[model samples]
Target: MATLGTVTFNNSSATSIFHTSSSLKFSSKPLLLPTRFSPKTPFPLRILRIYALSSNDIKVGTNLEVDGAPWRVLEFLHVKPGKGAAFVRTKMRNYITGNTVEKTFRAGSTIDEANVFKEAKQFTYKDGSQFVFMDLNTFEEIRLNEADVGDKTKWLKEGMDCNLLFWNGKVIDFELPITVQLAVVDVDPGLKGDTVSGGSKPATLDTGAVVNVPLFINIGDQILVDTRTGQYMNRA
Candidate 1:
């Protein structure tokens, strides 16, 4: 029996050290156990962490390593089955191809986390085949070639802000502003009383991207265009 005046400790190594004395005034309270522990992972376990993750541990806006590339999670939902185990449903976008994927994972499943970094960069002048960008926080210049930028190069403008994505220290992708203001370099003039909402005409922007704008849009007019779809959004 434990003495009433002093605390007795259990020396078992399998348990944690967090405990309360049985002689304390609140002796009726149960002992508290830790929910999780930070233990050193084994070598084999480390290799398994390369591309696996528990369904409950996934979060939106996080990068997951699938196959040889990184994919960014756009949405996630947790589902519980009455007859089976719980699972997670996720909608992820490929950082390399700009494609989307819908995946499901069991409650205890694991997936690898992608090693990705993002930097706020300002677009600079383009060289022979390379586009230059300056890090906004460090002012360091980085030059990426056509292949590194993919189709995103068409969206860049000098001195414009861009979000640069790096996968394992290699330039991979870039995200453009949702809406950009551009002047129409060429467009056919619309007639008076041509206020039809269904009317449309092709207009060429200063950047050379041709878009179908409403009849009212004219040459030299500055308008907002969505970069994702290359569509006119509104007048700037």
Candidate 2:
């Protein structure tokens, strides 16, 4: 009987070998394959692959999938005892729930790398309770509910650029710029003795977020705010 040389393929690349009675043909060029597999593909190659990472590969900002959830590594430490196998200790935060958890893994253990990515989006407006964002690249409007926006809703302003976090091609969360400048819409009048360090007052921003500002800050003043802590930074 006659046989054709082995053929191997995957989502990224493929190779084919042809064999005959006279000689063997070898092609070193990598064959281009689709990024995705079709349902009709062979059972062995039909499934998509999720990259595996060694415990030693974990580092801050690394995204991982654990217990069926996507988590970002906030901190990691390597421990090697006197007479035991090495291990990794990690603190991870869930992308969806914003919860932090401590997990340990044996050295050289395999971990699933989460398919997480971010897309640039611009805040367009609010439709009822949903906030609409337009993808900078695709120009597609993505509507996120109130809960998804959470406390960040206060910092959202029309035309503001933000980063939308995606896991498995779906939006999991969004992040605003670390600092934003907004006009103070309302605040109590400052006294004659008021100074930058004299006292503080609650100031309502044009976007409806209230933050504590130095007594010297007044209505219609443009002030910079820290989005992470919702605190007034300084005059813009």
Candidate 3:
């Protein structure tokens, strides 16, 4: 399918990548891509750039500041095809848009790395456009908005602990735990034979997030969900 604003890795070198099955593997060709990317910038692509890093300088989980957007390396593959110069194939997901892209690079190709760091913080509240977080140890309050945390805000729950991602000391994003337990605030009444394999039903979580749970799940039930997919895991 067509992707609106995904990066085209020009001149990539050796790297790795993951396929549709979410399994890690090595490949030299581009794979199917997500539909759309987010966060439009007013300036031209090259103007607000930073950190022109080489192909070898990045690894899985490296963040890049691409055209004023935050992108993370999901996977990469290094190819040494005899017919061509070695190249690195990599998959990138934009933090702002949540879109994934595949790019190839050789020795000269470069990507801009994002200067970011993460801090442990507790969710306090939202003040205007900014969300408030307090450092557990330092007890210092950090205020950040959409430009910082992206879409993760929807899952934010008061008193929940999370990792606040900062770029140049500015709030850029936040991450919840890998798996979190949330109370089911709304869901259809469970029926018989609603075991894990039977079927699934939509449930509204306490955080205002909706996820599919097994037929046995009911309102007031606490369930564990994988934050990465927002999918139901098991009973809390």
Candidate 4:
């Protein structure tokens, strides 16, 4: 019977085995392998912001970020006729206040867009010094301070829809409807034949808002008024 011995595969044992196999092998050289080259993945191209502007660059309906507020382009025109540098005439609406203002921008100019958030809500009621509004979509109610409501308080009526503008999650201003119906509380008695001359009379509404009504308007009459121009509309 032949006896078998266990063999271990180690560096020193391999060297000893190689030495014992020297008689059978001619050389003890190691084989060389080729090196690998990995190609890098290409990256996506990034888009750069463009802010090059000129005095003649003002366009109607252009959204502008100015003075840290977002404004909508209401009207704009470029003036450049046999003069110095051209100037841009613009009328913009404050996104938060719903107020319109006229401003001039350099013909070629770039401005940042005001980062503001806005939503439509229904005017609910006033709680002491705070005015409350409910979201039209979610029915969620929010309280706003008197400062945020500003002059809009005159136009705010229960159940009226308005736009609430926010800056960094803080209520800033409100946008009221252009026209609203209000009951006349007091007014100069209308004089007959005054309508022929298209005369106007000062009238006080139930909401405490004053408007110029037609000469025929009288107290206790319900009238529609243009909130923007403070002019009276037809009787309600």
RMSD of each: 13.2, 9.2, 14.3, 23.8
What TM-score does each of the candidates earn? Answer: 0.67, 0.76, 0.66, 0.61
Q: What lDDT, from 0 to 1, does candidate 2 have?
A: 0.79
lDDT of 4 at 103: 95
lDDT (0 to 1) per candidate: 0.72, 0.79, 0.72, 0.68
- Candidate 3: worst 10 consecutive residues by lDDT? 40-49
Q: Across residues 1-236, which tens digit of lDDT does each residue of candidate 3 receive?
A: 42254333322322421123546453566433333422332111221123468787778998877767788999988888889688888899977567899977785566667766677889888888888888776667877766666667657778889987765435656789888878999999997777746788889998888998889998999989888988888998
Ranking by TM-score: 2, 1, 3, 4
* Per-residue error (Å), model 2, residue 127: 0.3
Highest-lDDT candidate: 2
lDDT of 4 at 57: 55
Best by TM-score: 2
User: TM-score of the candidate numbered 3?
Assistant: 0.66
Q: What is the C-alpha lDDT profile of model 1 across 1-236, one tens digit per residue?
A: 32122223223311222244655343333333322212321101111112345568888988888777799999999999899888999999998788998998888665667757666788888999998988765567888888877766655678788877777545678778888888899999977766666788999888778889989888999988888898889888
What lDDT score goes with residue 67 in model 3? 67
Estimate, for each residue in 1-236, the C-alpha lDDT of model 4 and write its tens digit.
32222222333224422345546543344322232222220111122122323436557766666776767888988888697877788899986777899998766654544445467888988999999898766666888888777776776789898877655345666678888988888988888788787888788888788888888889998888787777777998
